[model samples]
Target: MMLLPDAEQLLANLTERMRSGVATDTAIVGIHTGGAWLAERLHHDLKLPLPLGTLDISFYRDDFDKIGLHAQVRPSDISFEVEGSHIILVDDVLYTGRTIRAALNELFDYGRPSSIRLAALIDRGGRELPIAPQYVGATLALPSDKMLALEKSSTGKLSLRLYDKNPMGHEQ
Candidate 1:
């Protein structure tokens, strides 16, 4: 059995690093689902002045034609101006980089930002595209058949879970 790192501690470390490095004008935007949850904590802990943004990225996914729409699709929301502002794109895991690509496609639709930095809770080693996280809480390696996921409790505690990848190429 693979021993996972503590999600809460990892998050605390990530927030501290971001607190010192992020630009004053930087905006935090989380990808839907897990990313959104992490972003919420980061935004509050970092004390960012700008409103938090969340991206669904469902429609922007490159494999949209193959997978079609997801069951729970939330609309992307960016209340602040995107042009000329620095953006910290948050995600739970950085794996294939395809999700980041889709997020970039959706973000540009709002307007070009001055800069965009990726922040991931975990950085798994597989990379199908050239993408890297500027800030990472942890780096873990696991078998191709296993998947890592972040879970949040009703009281807002965070934890990590390992699941066997479904044979159909979907997460359980």
Candidate 2:
């Protein structure tokens, strides 16, 4: 069994790294689900001025035709201006980079930002694309068959879970 690292500690470390690097005008946006959860904590801890934003890249996903719609697709919420503002796109795991690509495509629809940086809680090295994270909590290597996920408790505690991917499940 793979021993998982502490998610709270990882987030704490990631927050510190982001604190020094981000500009005061930087806006934070989290990918839906795990990324959104992480972004919520980071946004509060970092005390950003802009309202927090989230992306639901379901429609923008390259595999939308292949996979069809996700059961729980939520609308993206970006209340602040996108143009000329620095953006830090947050995600729970950085793997194939497809999700980030989809997110970028969606974000541009709002308007071009001055810059967009990536922040991931875990960087699992299996990249089909050339994308990478500027701020990361941890770097891990696992078999392709294994999956890692971020979990949040009802009381808002965070944890990591590693498990075998279903044989029929599509890769993220």
- Which candidate wins on TM-score? 2
Clashes of each: 0, 0
lDDT per residue as tens, model 1, 42-126: 9998988899999998888777676678778898899999998899999998888999999998999999998999999999878
Please write out the lDDT profile of model 2 over residues 1-172, one tens digit for every residue.
7788999999999999999987668899999989999999999999998999999999898877776888789999998999888999999989999999999999999998989999999999999998989999999998998988899999999999988998655456
User: In candidate 2, residue 80 scores what lDDT?
Assistant: 92
lDDT of 1: 0.89
lDDT score, residue 94, model 1?
Answer: 82
Candidate 2 stretches with Cα past 4 Å from truth are 168-170
